[model samples]
Structures are given as structure tokens and as C-alpha cells.
Target chain A: MKQKIRIGSGAGFSGDRIEPALILAEKGELDYLVLECLAERTIALAQKEKLANPELGYDPLLEKRLIGLLPLLARKKIRLITNMGAANPIAAAKKVREMLVKAGLNLKIATVTGDDVLEKLDLNELSLEGNKAIKNYPEIISANAYLGHEGILEALQNEAQIIITGRVADPSLFLAPMIHEFGWDTQNFDLLGKGTVIGHLMECAGQITGGYFADPLKKPVPGMETLGHPFADIFPDGKAIISKVNGTGGVVNLQTVKEQLLYEVINPFQYLTPDVAADFTTVKLHDLQNDRVEIRDGTGNKRPETLKVSIGYLAYFKGEGEISYAGTGAFERAKLAEEIIVKRIGNQFSEFRTDLLGINSLHKSTFGQDTIPYEIRLRVAGKARSIEDAKLIGEEVEALYTNGPAAGGGVIKRASEIIGIVSVLMNRKKINTQVTYL
Target chain B: MKLLEIAHSRAGDKGNISTLSLIPYEEKNYQLLCEKVSIEKVAAHLKNIANGKIERFELPHISSLLFVCHDALETGVTTSLALDSHGKTLSSALLEMEI
Candidate 1:
């Protein structure tokens, strides 16, 4: 049996930086490198692209990422796992196969599918968000149920070096490797829970490596521009050490790990995934003092019978326009511009909002700051039923340069259809998962 | 004293809910954070952005506090018209609270 296995995180979200991932594949002596690229709203956008072209639904950066890492991944014999398959895994795997052939590098690839459950969905089912029936939503785009590590594990067991999946739980992308390496039993909830904790910590790539934890003077980080990604060295007992590449820009300490522990998490006691109800509260962290932290004591119970499905539908069109004002009474001019735009097209859309960017735009609450800024930007946004109606908002704001506010410069306008995403629970047995090798 | 002096935070969003983690710079200040930072106080501080139920989860081992606010992101990021739809800045806003 191997003493330990090292796993490095490549990408956190869909648009994360690509250079740091290359650094991991080259320097980090990793057995497995997992790139978690999908976010909650990512697949929904991919679905729109798929509707336009059958083979274009996968992540746009799939080719770029593979082009850069395939040589190193092959040379290092490091297995790659990712949900870059977004809305379509088959096409993504095919693209990777083509790249492998062109580069004269022979690598096994596996594609996992069947997460899409639109036809299997019952319109009468209530959404977990607002308790509204699925039928009430119009223009449904896609519905993908979050799968577990079973699919990826099957591919790994089959000796597939590259595993591509659609809409699997983010942490499962990292957890599957542990199960495959250690030959862990499916029913071992405690081990699975500990593995899940490791997955959660490494899933966000740079977040735990001090990308989001930096502050000037208070919490100073050395290299903001070249922040390195993190990796976990896991033992057979499921205990792991979190660390980053040596001489890297970021720091992996107790605070960064603690912040990431509760990120997007409501209750630390029970963090529900498809594999296990992992308990984060029971987990413990130890700062090793040199960009390394030993984490242990993770536990969990059984997995849930139901799976969470993300449902995407067309909600409304949003239009926005912005113009800047500077020097001597700039705030007053911006306020006047907001008033003029609100009076012209305020009653047209269902929701209209006007704000001065330097003022109360971010937190709509009034804290009453002591000083007033000499420069401000007027922003007007509204939601409408049709694209044409939404365009009117920007057009009116543009008219201000010629008619309403004085010295209104740098006018910008945007109008796009908003895709509203919600979630619903589905029986795990109802969704069938399949894996195919390329 | 401002909460920023003792603690730092990061914001995350799921659906219409916003989750923030407040971790003290020193473990000794964890008790002070627990005493001063309450769900009611947090809801009052962010009354403009979030109006739904507020719940706090404690991780004494790590000496951190997590606050979950529902109906927070103005109907979530996909549909919300707010400039900061994901409520990413809400973490800094929460740090402005006086202790």
C-alpha cells in the first residue's frame, strides 16, 4: 500500500486563472490533480450555448486547459478529474481525445453522464428555494441533478486516467480519488466524511491559499499577483495536510483555512453532499507553521436518499446604463441624472433601481458617512419582460448626455436576458448515471 | 472598537441566501466575538440588504462564527438587479459593525 497520496486543486470556478494550475502540475508531486470548474449558475449558461450548437455546451476553456496540461499530466502520470464537462461531457471528452491524438500522447479518458433530468422531472414538484411549482416557471433551459463520486470512482477503477463529469457535487471530484486509492468501502461513512472534508477544503483551489484572505497591513499577503494553488497530502486513515508550493505568493495558515471551512456553508455540523452528511464542526486544524496545516478529526453519518437538482429557466431581461460625473457638485449632478431617468421610464419596468455608485449602491442601507465624495457615477437599472423594453432603459440614460445632466461622460449601456436558477430535490434512484471511455 | 479590528470575514452566496464567516485574528478574542456578534445585531446591521431569517453557527475549535442570512442577495445573483448581486461586499459591510 502507498504511504500517502497527494492531490492538487487546479481551478476553482469556470473563469479561474490557468497559470497556477500549470505550476501545480509541474512542481507539486501530485498523484491526482482535480480542477473544479463548474459553479451553481455555470451549467445553465452552458445549456444556452448547447442549444445554439450541439457540441459547444462544454466549458470554453476545456481545450485551452488541456492543451497546456496534457503533456505534463502524461509525463507525471497524474490523473485528471474535472466537471469542465459542464452541460456536455461527451463532447468534452471527444475534444480531449482529439488533442491527445494530435499531440501523439496516448491517454485514457472517461465521460460520465445522465445528470440531466429534465424529462424525468415532475412539473408539480416544488422548488427548494421559493416553494413554487416547476410548472409555474416558463422557458425551462436545463435541470441537472448533482451526482456523487460513484461515477468518477467507476472510471478510476476502470483505469481511466482522465475523468470528465457533468454536474457532480464539487467535493466529489476530489473525494473519488481517495476512495479509489485506498480501496475504501462505500458504506464507510466516517472515512467518506473525512474524505469529503478534504475535498471541500481543496475544491476552491486558491481560496484556501490566501487568494481571498489578503488585506493591506492588517493581514498582509506576500505576492498578490502570483497566488499559488493548494494541495492536500492524504494518508490511508483519511488525515491530510494542506499546503502550497514553496516560494509561492500566498500563505496557507489557520485563518485562511478557517474562513474557507465555513464558506457557502450555513451549518457546519451537517454539510450535506451526495456521498455523506459530513460534519465540519468535528474537524480540527493544526497550523504546521510553514505553509502547511495538518487537518484531522472529520466524521459523518450516511448519505441522503435525495439529490439536489439545479433548474434553470428564463426569468426576465435586465437593462443597465452608467455615466460618470466629476469635480464640484458631482454628487448633485448624479442625483439629478437619477431623478431624470426615474421620471422618464420608472413606471415602464416591473423593477426600477437608481443609484449613485460612490454612495449607497453596494449596501442599499444608509450608514450616513461623514464626508461626501466630489466624484460619483449615476447608474440606472431595470427589469423588463422583453429585450426591447429593457433596451429602452439604456437608451434613456444615453439621452442624458444630450439632454438632462451636464458633463455626463463615459456612458455605458447593457441589456441581456436573465436566467433564473433554482433548486429541487429528486430521488437518487430516479437519475441513472453512466460512464463511457474514450 | 470596530469588529474589523478583532475579526476578518469572507462572504459566499447560495440561491437567495448569503453566508459570512467571521474569524478572529487571535483565538483569545473568539469569546468577545461570540458575546458581541448576535443574529439580531447582524440582521439590524444589514437591515437594508437582508430582511429574512438570520442564524448563527459556531465553530469553537476554529474560534469562528458563521452567519447565514436568507432573502439576502435581492432575489439572488442570477436575477438580482443590485450592482453587487452576490453580496460579496456584504462581508466588509458586516466588518464595519462597532463592538
Candidate 2:
């Protein structure tokens, strides 16, 4: 049995920095590099793309990322895992195969499916608002349940070098490798929970490695321009050391790890994942020498009986317009512009919002009547039922330059459809994972 | 003193709920933070942006306090009209609180 396994985080999201991933793959001396790319809304967008082109539902950067990492990965014998197969794992695996063939490198690829439970779901059985059935909304685009580590462990058992999955729990990507390498039992909830905590900490990549933990003098990090990615050294006992690659920029300390440990978490005592109900209240972090933090004692209970499913639907068309004003009572001019735009489009769109930037845009209730600034930007945004109606908001804001507010410049407008997300609980037996190797 | 002097924070969002973690840089300040950073003070400080219920969880082992503010991200990330729909900047805003 291996004493320890090192797993590096390549990408936190779909659009994360690629250079850091390259550095990790080349120099991190990692056994596995996991890239978590899918967000709650990404799958819905991918599903929309798939509706247009049947073979194009994965992440757009999948091909480029594979091309950049394949040669090094093949030479180093390092395994890769990712959820970049946003809506289509099969098609994504095929694309990876094509890239490998062109590079003349031989590597086994495994794709995990069965997360997409749209067809099997009963909308009438699910509720959105209080007692409101999902069937009432006729515009759901995609629905995928969060899978566990069983499929990923199966892929590793098949000796697949690269594993692709759709909508698996983010922590499962890291936990599966540990379970595979250490031969841990599937029912070991405490160890799974411990591994899940590590996955949650490292899933965001730079966030836990001083990328997001930087302040001017309070918490300054060196080499912010070239922040390094994070990696974890896990042992058979479920304890691990979190650190970054050698000669990297970011700092790994107890603060960074603690902040990430509770990031997006509601109740620390009950962090429910598909594999285990992990508890973070008792997890301990010790600051070691040379930017390493040792994490230990993460406890867990049995996994939840039902898995959480992310459902995305076509919400509405959003229209936004911005106009700036500067010098000689700019706040008054921006306020006038806001009033004018609202007067022109307010009756048409009830969901409209107008803000005087640099003033009460972000925290309006507290800073609403604060001191006026010398310069301000007027922004008007609203949701409309149709694109044409949404475009009217921007048109009115642009018209303020010539007709309403004097010295109004830098008019910008945008209109796009918004995707809405909702969550539902599904029985574990309803969703069955299958793996395809190439 | 400013909260940033002794603690650092990171914010995350799930649907309309936004969570921010406040971890003390020195273990000695954890008790000070627990006493000064009350849910009422947080709600009062952030009364402008987040008008929802705020729940605080204490993790003494890590010397951190996690605050989960419900309905805090306007209408959530995908549908919110704000430039930062995920409420990522809320951490900085929370750091501006005085203790």
C-alpha cells in the first residue's frame, strides 16, 4: 500500500487560469490532478448548446486543456480527473481520445454517466416554492443529480488514466482517488468525510492557496501575479497536508484552509454530500513549516438517503445599461439620468432596478443617503419576458446622453437570457452510474 | 479596531444564501471575535444588502465563525442583476465592520 498520495488541483472552475495547471502538471510531482469545472449554471448552458448541436455539451476549453496537459500527463504517468464533461461525458471522452490520437500518445479514458436524471424525474413530485410543483414551470433545461465516488472508484479499478464525469459531487473527485489508492471500504463514512473535507478545501484551487486570502498589509501574499495551485498529501488515516507546488507564489496557512473549509457551507455539523455527511466542526488544522497545513480529525455519518439534484431552467431575459457622469455635480446628473430612464421604461418592466454607482449600488439600505461623490455611474437593469422588450432598457439609457443628462458619456448596454436554478432531492436507487472506457 | 486586524474572511454562495467565514489570524483572538461578532451586530452592519436571517456557527477547533445569511444574494447568482451576483464582495464588506 502507498504511504501517501499527492493530488493537485488543476482548475477550480471552467474559466480558471490555465498556466497554473500547466505548472502543476509539469512540476507538482502529483499522482492525480483533478479539475472541477462545472457550476450550477454551467450544465444548463451546456444543455442549451447540446440542444442546438447534439455533440457539443461539454466545456469549450476541454479540448485546449487536454492538448496542453496530455503529453506531460502521459510522460509522467499521472492520472487526471475532471467534471468538465458538463452535460455530455461520452462526447467529451471521444474528444479526448481524438486529441490523444493526434498526439500519438496512448492513455486509457473513462467516462462516468447517469447523473442526468431529466427523463426519469417526475416534475409533479418536486416542488419549487412552497407546495408549488416543478411541472408548473415548462422551461426546465437540465436536471442532474450529484453522484458519489462509486463510479470514479470503478473507473480507477478499470485502470483508466483519465476520468471524466458529469455532475458528481465536487469532493467525490478527490475522495475517489484516496479510496482507490488506500483500498478503503465504501461504508467507511468517517474516512470518506475526512477525504471530502480535503476535496472541499482544494476544489477551488487558488482560493485555499492564498489567491483569495490576500490583503494589503493585513494578509499580504507574495507573487500574486503568478499564484500557485494547491495540492494535498493524503495518508491512509484520512489526515492530509495542504500545500502548493514548489517555487510558487501563494501562501498556505491555517487561515486559508479554515476560510475554505467553511466556504459555502451552511451548517458545519451537517455538510451533506452524496458519499458522506461530513462534519467540519471538529476538523483541526495545524500550521506546519514551509507553507504546509496539516488537517486531521474530520468525522462523518452515513450518506444521505436522497441525492441533491440541480435543476436549471430558462428564467427571463435581462437587460442592462450603464451611463457615466463626471465633474460639477455628477451625482445629481446621474440621479437625473436614472429618473429619466425609469420614467421611460418603468411602467413596462416592473422588475427594473436603478442604481447610482459609487453610492448606493451594492449596499443601498445602509449607504443609501451617504455623501455624494464627484463622479458616478447610472445603471439600470431589468428582467423582461422577451429580448426585444429587454433591449428597450438599454436604448432608453443610451438616449440619456443626448436628450436627458448633460455630459453623460460611455454608454454601454447588454441583453441576455438568464438561467434559473432549483434543487430537488432524489432517491439514490433512481440514479445509476455507468462508466465507458476508451 | 477593524475586524480585518485580527481576522480574515472568504464568502461563498448557494442559491440565494451567502456564507462568509471569519477566521482569526491568531488563535488568541478567537474568543474576542466570538464575543464581539454577534448575529445582531452582523445583521445591523449588513442591513443594507442582506435583509434576511443570519445564522452563525462556531468552530472552535479552527478558531473560525461561519455566518450563513439567507436570501442575501439578491435573486441568486444566475438571475441577479448585480455585477457580482455571487456576493463574493460581501466578505470585504463584512471586514469593514467595526468591533
Candidate 3:
């Protein structure tokens, strides 16, 4: 058994900086460089792209990121794992194969599919938020179940250098590599949970580091401009140490790790994933020297019987317009503009919102009315059935330029289609995972 | 003193629920955080924007408190018409609350 293996995070999201990943590939001695680029709605967007062109369902930055890391990966013999395939893994794998061949690098690549369960799923069987039926929305663009580590482990076991997947769990991308290397059993819930905690911490790339840990003078992190990405050193026992690259500008302490541990998590005792039900409440973190923090004692119960499926549907057309007002009575003028808009195009839009940007936009009704601001931007947005109907909301707001509000400047208007998401639970037995190598 | 004086926070959204983790710089402040930052106080503080039930989880090992505010994002990120769809700035907004 290996004593320890290092896995570095390349990119956190789809559009994350690629240069930091190259730095890891070149300098950081890593067994695997995992890039978690898929977000909840990203695959849905990719599905739309796939509809336009069958060969373009993967992440837009896939080519750019590979162009930067392929050479270093080949040199270092570092394996690459990513969920950047989005809605299409085969096309992404093909693209990577073409890139590698062009560079004359004989690297093995694998793609995992079967997460796209749209066709197999019955809308009647699915429910969203207590009794809400999926059948109500007929415009579903994409439906994908969150796959576990089985497919990823299968790919690794086949000696694939690069593993690309679609709609796998974020932590699974990191955990699969650990499971394959350590020869860990799939049914070992405790080890799986422990490994998952490591994956979760390192999944956000720089969150465990200091990218999202800065607060100017309050909690200052050095080298904010070129923040370092995070990596984990996993031991045979499943305990791991989370740290960043040497000479990189980011802190890995209890505070940063703790903040990230609870990020996007609901119940501390039950962080549900396909592999394990991880209990992070008892997890401990010790700050070691050189920006390393040892994380231990992550326990788990049996895995959930069902998997969560993210379903994206065409919601409606959104029309938005923003116009700024300045000087003494700016708030009043913005309010007047909102009232005028409601009077003009209120019935046209199915649902709409008007906000005074500088005033009570974010924390609405939280702060009591006080002193009037020098400037206020009136933003009115609405959703309609059609693009032409949605455009009217923006048009009505633009009419305020000549129709009402005094000194309305910087008028910006836009109309676009909105994607709506619904979550449903699917039985684990229903979904099947497939792995293919190229 | 304000919450920002002693603690730092990060907020993230999953569907309509938004979770904010408040981690104190000093371990001693964990007790103070538990005392001052209650579910009621948090719900009251964000009463305007967050209209759902508030649940708090204590992670004493890490000296942090997590607040999960349901129905907080106006709606989900993809569906919400709000300016800050992900509610990323809610952590800073919550930090502004005086203790």
C-alpha cells in the first residue's frame, strides 16, 4: 500500500484561471491534478450547446486548459481527472485525444457516461419539493443523475491517464483517485466518507487556500493577486493534510478549512453523496507548519439509497433594463421610474421585480428608510413566455428616458431565455455507469 | 463590537437555501459566538430577505457556527431575478450585524 499520495486541484469552476493549474502541473509533484469544472447549471447550458452542435457539449475552456497542462502532465506523468465533460464526455475525450495526438504525446484517455438519465426517467415518477411533479414542466432541457466513484475507479483501474466524466459528484472526482490508489473497498463507508471530506475541502481549488478568505484589513491574505490553489496529501488510513503549493500566496489554517468545510453544506452530520453519508461534525483540523493542516476523524454511515438528479428546463424569457439616477432626489426618481414601468408593462410580464440598486436591493426591507443616497440605479426585470414579450419590459424601462425620470442615464436593456432547475431523487438501481477508453 | 471584528464568514447557496459559516479567529470566541449568534437572532437579522426557517449547526472542533437559511435566495440561483443570484455577498451582509 502507498504511504501517501498527493492530489492537486487545478480549477474550481468551469471558468477558473488556467495559469494556476499549469503552475501545479509544472511545480507541484502530484499523482493527480483534478479539475472540478462542472457547476449545477453548467451541464444544462452545455446541453443547449450540444443541441446546437453535437461536438460541443463539454466545457468551453476544456481545450484552452488542456493546451496549457498537456505538456506538463506528459512530462510529470501526472494523471488528470475532471468533470469538465459536462453533458458530453465522448466528445470531450475525442477532443483531448486529438489534442494529444497533435502534440505527439501517446497519452491514454477515458470517458465515463450514463449520468444523462433524461430518456430513462419518467416525469411522473419524479417529484420536486414535496409532491411537485416534474411532468408540469414540458420544456426540460437536460436531466443528469449525480454518479458515484465506481465509474471513475473503473477508468483508473484500466490505466487511463486522463479521466473525463459528466455529472459525477464533485467529491467523487477526488475520491475515485484515492480509492483506486489505496485499493480501498467501495463498501468501506468510513474511509469513503473520510476521503470525501478531503475531496470536498480540495474541490473548491482555492477556497481551502485563501482565494475566498480575504477581508482587506480585517482578515488579510497575502498575495491576493496570485492566490494559490489547494491540494491534499492522503494517507493509507484515509486521513489527509490539506495544503497549497510552495512559494504560492495562500494560507491553509483551521479557519480557512473550517469555512470551506461548511460551505454549500446543509446538515453537518449528514452531507449526502452517492458514495457515503459523510459526518463532518467530528472532523478535526490541526494547523501544521508550511501552510499545511491535518484533517482527521471524518466518519460516515451507509450511503443513501437514492441519488439526487438535477433537471434543467426552459423556464421563461427574461427581460431586464437598468437606468441610473443621480443627485438630491435620485431615490425618489428611481421609485417614480419603477411605478411608471409597472403602470406601463406590468400585466405583460408574468412576474417582475423593480429595485433601487444603491438603496434596498440586496437586503430588501432589512434596513429602515434613512438618508437618501446621492445615486440610485433603477433596475426592472421580468419573465415572460416569449422573447418579444420579454423585450417589452426593457422597452418600457427605456421609455423612462424620454417619458419620466429626471436625468436617467446609462440605460442598458437586455432580453434572454432563462433556465429553471428542479431537483428529484432517483433509485440507485435505476442508473448505470459506463466507462470507455481512447 | 461587530461580528466582523472577531469572526470571518463565507456564504454559499444550494437551491433556495443559503448557508453561511461564521468562524472566529480566536478559539475562545466560540463560546461568545454560540451565545450571541443564535438561530433566532440570525433569522431576525436577515428577516427581510430570508423568510424561511433557520437552522444552526455547531462545529466546536473547528470553532465555527453554520447557519442554514431556507428560502433565502428569493428563489434558486438559476430562477431568481435577484441581482446577486448566488447570495455570495450575504456573508459580508451578515457580518455587519452588531453583537
Number of the top candidate by DockQ? Answer: 1
Error of 2 at A263 (Å): 0.6
Q: Across residues A1-438, which tens digit of lDDT does each residue of candidate 1 receive? A: 687999999899889999888999999999999999998878998999998999889999998887989999999999999999999999899999999999999999999999999899999999998799999998899999999999999999999999999999999998999999998898999999999999999999999999988988678888979999999999989999999888778999999999898889977888999999999998899999999999998888899999999999999999999999999988888988988888889999999999888788998754656466877888999999999999999899899989967899999999998999988999999999999998
| Candidate 1 lDDT, B14-55, residue by residue in tens | 889999999999999999999999988998898888889999
Q: Rank candidates by DockQ, best first.
A: 1, 3, 2
Model 2 steric clash pairs: none
Off by over 4 Å in 1: none
Query: What are the TM values for chain B, all candidates?
Result: 0.98, 0.98, 0.98
Error of 1 at A326 (Å): 1.0
Better structure of 1 and 2 per TM-score: 1
Write the candidate numbers in order of decreasing TM-score.
1, 2, 3
lDDT by residue for model 2 (A148-259), tens: 9999999999999999999999999999999999998889899988999999999999999888888878888899889999999999999999998889898998878888
TM-score of 3: 0.97
TM-score of 1: 0.99
Q: What lDDT score belongs to each candidate, Candidate 1 first?
A: 0.92, 0.89, 0.89
Q: In lDDT terms, how accurate is model 3?
A: 0.89
Lowest lDDT block of 10, candidate 2 chain A? A363-372
